[model samples]
Target chain A: MRPVEVGHRGGERAPRSTRLLGRHELPIACEADIVLVRRKARSLAQAYGFDAFATAAITTAASELARNCWVHGGGGAAVVEELYDGTRHGLAMEFRDTGPGIGDVEWALAGGHSTTRSLGLGLSGSRRLVDEFALETARGEGTTVRIVKWKRF
Target chain B: MSPIPILRIGTTLLCSVHVELDDALAERLQEDVLGTIERTGATGLVVDISGLETVDSYVARILADTGRMARLMGADTVLAGMRPEVAATLVRMGFPLEGVRAALDLDHGLALLAHGRSGATEGRRPGRTAP
Candidate 1:
C-alpha cells in the first residue's frame, strides 16, 4: 500500500509509538529492481517527513541491502515501510531471499568481507548508514535483513 | 540491458553515471570503458556521478576499480561532480575509494587529467620540456 502523505503542517496524526505506517513490496531480481528499491526508499522516506540528507542515507542503506539480496541470494523481495517511535520517525527496509545462506555472520558484518565478488561492504556499509540493523539466515531456510534509519533533528 | 554512456572529449573520455548502477551494469561499464580507451587511445578518463542521487558502497567500489583499471590501461582517471551528501555517505560507510582522484567539476577534472598526462609525458622523456 502507498504511504499516507500528510503535509508537514502539524496536527495530522502524531505517531505516538513505534509502528508501521505503510508497506511496499518489490521483487529483487535484476539490476532494474535495485534502482526501483532505491526510488521507493527515497519517496517513502520523504513521505515520512525525512529531510533530504536523511532521505539519502535511507536510500543508500536500502540500495545496499536490496542489491545484496539480489546478488548473493539469487533473488528476493523488499518491504519498504514508514515507521515512528514516539516523536522520532524513521524509515524501515527489510529484504528477504532464498539462496545460499551466509556462512559466517561475524565475518559478513565485520567489514571487508563478501561471499561473492564484491567490495564486501554491502552488509557492513548498510549497517553504518542506519540506526538499527538485524540479519537472520539459515543454511537452507533463506536470509532476512532488516534495517531502520531514524530521521535526524 | 543498456550500459551507461561513456563520452569521448578531446584526450579525455568522460563517463557520467546518470542512472542507478547495478553489479551487471557496472561490469559492463568497466568493459566498455576499457574497450573505448583501447580503441580511442585516450589518455584521460573522468567519471561523473553528480546525476546519481545516492550511491552505495558497491557502486563506489566499482568507480574506484574503474579508476584503477583505466590507470592500468595507460590512462589517468579523474572523478568529478560527486554530491557532498553522497560523498559523506560513502565516507561514513567506510568506502576508502583507494586510487580514485576526485575534482569538484568537469572543468577541474579535465585540468587534473591534463596535468597528470603532462607529468607522465615528462617522466617518460626525462629531458623533455613543455613548449
Candidate 2:
C-alpha cells in the first residue's frame, strides 16, 4: 500500500498502486438526473463493501453535487468509478459542467451562500461528507468537482 | 413525474414519501399538502420518510418549509421515520430541521397529533396545539 498524502488544498491523492476497477458516466440535465446519479453512487458504494453509514454519506454527497450541477451549473455530467489500491478500495466521482461557472468559489465553499433559491449547502456540505474533495472552476468556463471516499477496513 | 401521495385520516394528513423526489416533485408535494389541508381542514400533517434512502440539503429544505407552511395553515406537522444514516448526513449538512417536530415512526407521529389535539382542548399542554 502506498502512503496517502493530503494535499494543501485538503484533497487526498489516490495511492500510487491504485487501479481503476470500473467507470460509469451519468448526465445531470435535470432534477430527475440527480436521483439517478445518487442511486448509482449508492449501489456502487454498497457493492464496494462500504458500510451503511459510509454508503449514506457517499450517496448524500453525490446528491448534493449532482443538484448543484443541474441547478447552478446549468447541467453537467458525472463520472463514477471504483478504484482499488493494493490494500483498500475507493470510490471516486467527478462532476463536470460547462455552465456559467463560479466567480467566487471560496464564498461558495464558505457555506450558506447561494446563487439561486437554494440553501447554498451544496459545495461546503458535500465536501464535508467525503474523504477527499477537490474543486476546479473558472468564470464563464464551468466547474468540475471531484470526490473520493475510501472504504474503511 | 407523479407527486407523492397524501392520505387523510380523521383530522391528520399522512404523506408517505417512498420514492426519490426531484425538485419539481418536491415542490408539488408542498402545494398538494397545503391544498389538501385547506380543503379538508387537516389539523395535523405527518410526513413519513422511512423509505427514503437519502435526504440532501434541497430535499431537507422542502420538508422543513412544508412543515412551517402547514403550521401557518392551522395544522401541526410531524416528520417521522428518518433513517439513522440519513439523519446523520443531514446533521453533517447542517440542517437541524428547526421549527419542525419529528417522531420515530408512523405510529408515534399519529400519537403526537392526537396529543396535540387533546392538549388543544385542555389548553394546558405545551405541544403544538392551536391556541
Candidate 3:
C-alpha cells in the first residue's frame, strides 16, 4: 500500500505558521452572547495547547473586548487565529466594529477609563493579560483591537 | 456554559458558582437566587465563589444587592470561599463588599449562620423562632 497520509498533502506540517482559524459575526443585542464568546475563546485556546493560566488570561481578555463590542460599538465580530512562527507560540485575537470610533485612544487606554459604569479596567487590564496589544480606530472607520499572547514555560 | 449549583441544607441555601461574575451572570444569578429564597423560604443564604476566576464592579453590586434582598426577606446572607485574587480585584475595582459576612469555607459559613440564629433566639419568646 502507498504511504499513509500522515501530514498535509503538501508536506510535513510547517514548524511555525499563521492562519485565521475562526471568525464569529453576531449581533451584540443580547446578554447571552457574552457567555458564547467566552466559551469559544476557551475552546480555541485549549485546542491550541494554551496553558491553564494562559487560557484564563485569554478568556478574560476576550470578555473585555467582546464587552466593548457590545456596549460601545453597538455590535461587532471577532477573529481568532494561531501564529506559530512568532517569537513564541502565539494566539492572535482581533475584534472589529463599525460603530463610532473612540476619539481619545490614549485616554481610553489609560487604566480606570470607561465610558459606561463598568469596572473601568477594560483596555489596560486586557493589555496586561497578553504579550502584545494594539488598537486602531478612526472617526468614521470604527475600531479594531488586536491582542497577542505567547506560550510560556 | 454550565450553571452554578445551589445546595440546600436545612433552612440554609448554599450556591456554588464557577464562572466570572460579570453583568450577564449577575443578572441571571439575582433572579435564580431570589426565586430560590422565595420558593424554599430559606432562612440563610451562602454564596461560595472559590471557583470564580474574576468579578467586576457590576457583579459586586449584584452580590451586595442579593445580600440585601435576602435580608429583607428575613434571611441572613454570607459570602464564602472568595479567592484571594478575586478579592484583590474587587478591592482594586473599588467595590465595597466589606459589610457582607465572608467565611473561609462553606463549613465555617454554615457554622456562623447557625451561631447567629442561635444567638438571635436566645432569651426570646418561647413561641417565636429566629428567622
A1-153: candidate 2 lDDT, tens digit per residue = 112222222345676889999999999987789999999999999888898888999999999999899888899999999999778888999999998887777788889976786689988888888888878887788888888988888
Name the candidate that leads on DockQ: 2
What lDDT tens digits, residue by residue, belong to model 3 across residues A37-63? 767777878887877667767777777
Better of 1 and 2 by DockQ: 2
Per-residue CA lDDT of candidate 2, range B1-131, in tens? 33688999998899999977777878898999999999999999999999988888888899999999999999999898999999998888777577778888898788778877766432222334465
TM-scores, one per candidate: 0.84, 0.89, 0.67
Interface RMSD for all numbered candidates: 1.4, 1.1, 3.8
Look at candidate 3 and give me any clashing residue pairs. Answer: none
What is the lDDT, from 0 to 100, of the residue A54 in candidate 3? 71
Per-residue lDDT tens digits for candidate 1, residues A16-123, read 467877778999988689988999998888787887677778899888888888888998999987777776777778899998877777778878876676678888
Model 3: fnat (fraction of native contacts): 0.13
Q: Against the true structure, candidate 1 has what lDDT?
A: 0.79
All models, RMSD in angstroms: 7.6, 5.2, 11.3
RMSD in angstroms, candidate 3?
11.3
Cα shift from native, residue B47, model 1 (Å)? 1.4
Q: Once model 3 is optimally superposed onto the true structure by TM-score, how far is the C-alpha of residue A106 displaced, in angstroms?
A: 3.4
